[model samples]
Target: MSTTSVSISQKLTLSGSSSCNPRLAQAPWEFDAMPGYGPGSSEADPVPAHAPTNAEARPGQLPQLYRELPEEDLHERIRAAKEALGEDLVILGHFYQRDEIVQHADFLGDSFQLANAALTKPEARYIVFCGVHFMAETADILSSPEQSVILPNLAAGCSMADMADEDSVEAAWEEICEVYGVDPQNVTPDDDGKLPILPVTYMNSSAALKAFCGRHGGIVCTSSNAETVLEWAFERARRVLFFPDQHLGRNTAKAMGVPLEQMPMWNPRRPLGGNTAEDLQQAKVLLWHGFCSVHRRFSVAQIEKARSEHPGVKVIVHPESPMPVVDAADASGSTDAIRKFVAASSPGDVIAIGTEINMVNRLAAEYPDRTIFCLDPVICPCSTMYRIHPGYLAWVLEDLVQGRVNNQIVVPETVAAHARVALDRMLAAKPK
Candidate 1:
């Protein structure tokens, strides 16, 4: 049987040789104290170096007692807490989460899917989200006010989400509106009945960015529904300003036959987003300079290597990868699409996947009859998602059972109102 998770975890614990960072062998608490994105596909990314360490962002330490407990004991504690709380609690796990955490999840899927799951449990008082910060925030936004969303660890933040902030996006919007000679807050449609631009943010972004989209007649999009969302945007606007994920924006638009020249990259650091006014005017989609660190590690070279090693290998990748990598893959899609692809494959088919190692590994374990493996051979998971170890999940669940809500993710009411508009549009834009 293909046991990728076992190999990866063994390397992390016993050898520490499969990963780029040897520090990954230590407990998460040991590395959370450091100033970096932690060990994973983003181990070398420059963006996380300047951001606050996981320890600093967290409300308090994970506590020595929890960290010192054995892995099996921690799992038992989580199980006990769940039993004690019964229907009052629901745990949501992302596709990229570790096996230990995923096994404990009441709902296992992508960020949006998991968020939607929480809504189904209206009677549940607490939502323990075993995902990144933005995901928990999204749950808090979508669920009823009485329900609470908790992140297992405060440090589990997306590096890509950090790339685009409110200030940078707001500044770009002002400049773009000026170039079009329109008010940033109140843009009017031209004779063609299309607004000058419509803001669109990926699900990987912060709640503030999503709120910005809501206020500006924009919509939020997941990787699976991005094309449909873009089609929705184009129906109301001449151009789409997509943020917090350049690859997803560019790849989806390009698939829809938008010319490369018409999709410009917006660098917030540069003047006019480092583009000429003429270029901006001609653009169909303005992609922000942001990307998921895990997906960014995929390359055309890796695809070629997989193809060479296993003839007739079907390579599937996430759209968050670079254009060339997606182009080289046999198919590129969201996490759910990838899962469906594997499910549809023949029992003996060889599949190479380009995504977080944990997700790929889980798929491999699920379909042991097939030769399913990650395109990137390195055992790097998403650093942020990996931060949600069993220890954090156990601690959070126990705390909730004890009537304490730790690491609760609450979005401001004003922001949630606007964000809800964009999210609702996203829900409506789902292709028929």
Candidate 2:
């Protein structure tokens, strides 16, 4: 989620928008280039761009289309459902969700932020999370037991989170403890000095894993505030164990000037902890062997190509990408930061985005005067995010209207308590 203040001339018109369906809109969006305006140059020409590459092929990438209502009727139905459901319904959309569903979100942010938002709405009996399954579970953990969290599509899941499960994480933690010849509880400290290990989990993880973190004085984080959460951990511990997203963990630690060698990737499958004391003793961050398939698809070549093709293009990428990919781009940040930079940017600027395809397309539409295109030339939408179709959203809302709760996501009481501790730490870190 990074932004750049570069400028370019002309509008972008890629070939993919003319498809009959959203899924078929695969052609590269075209943008005009300005001379000498791109990275390393004050001005340059923008080049034609390609679609996103390495999109995760999540199952049910397309939900079944049950809604046959016309545009006006559909909106009317959605409004009526909301009115009937009243306080019992809440819609939460993730930052990477399609604009169609996001436009209807009552609350919008990253997974961690969205979960926190859900907690504030005590009156909402049913929280319809518009993100992936893990995000819905996070909201469930944060919300009161009396509340019900529903995912529009259960298939929506984070691939990164899938990389780390409770068993695997537990194994890794044990290995870390054994290698250090220290108890997990005695490894890290908090201001209270009560908890032994500060088990921090990423929002992308499973509820069970999150429960593990909660049980261990750890919290969850989205890409936006991961750095702050990690920093908070350091203040209370000898080292940090970041789960479910090695890229985010590595990049955040790197941003803090933590030596790259200090961050070791823990592999639960094999022993020796997948790291050495040299790597661990010097460790500032302990990364789980996990990654987002979609984010990892971004490459340095894409950025370089963008620069050469679009003479004046500014490169902006999400930190979830590999370090090289992030470094190749002119800027890196959260998705919200990227959007803000583009919306408020000056006209005639060229932007090459390294994010989901739908998001880049929406931005291009929002800024017609500026040249905007995605960094990856292949299809690269987050498969999990794409699982949340308007059809599924409408169905979930309609079910709530009918006084039925389907697909309710609930974290156990024990797990909830621990998860809250982790979540509270993050909320406290939010800038006042």
Which stretches of candidate 1 lie above 4 Å from their native place?
Answer: 1-6, 9-19, 48-50
Local error of candidate 2 at residue 295 (angstroms): 0.9
Candidate 2 segments whose C-alpha is farther than 4 A from its true place: 1-75, 185-197
Error of 1 at 181 (Å): 0.7
C-alpha RMSD in Å of predicted model 1 compared with the true structure: 2.4
Please give, for residues 1-432, the per-residue lDDT of candidate 1 as tens digits.
014445665565564334455455566777777777776644567653336765668776698899888888998999999999999999998999888888889999986577568779999999999999888888999999899999888888888999999999999999999999999989989999999999999988889999999999999999878999999999999999999899999999999999999999999999998999999999999999988877888889999999899999999999999999999999999898999999999989999999988888789889999999888766677887878888888888888888998888999999999998998888777642
> lDDT of all predictions, in order shown?
0.86, 0.68
Which model scores highest in TM-score?
A: 1
TM-scores vs. true structure, each candidate: 0.95, 0.81
Local accuracy of candidate 2 as per-residue lDDT tens digits, 161-266 = 6678777777787777776667765455445763333567777877787777766767677777888887777777777788877888888888888888778787
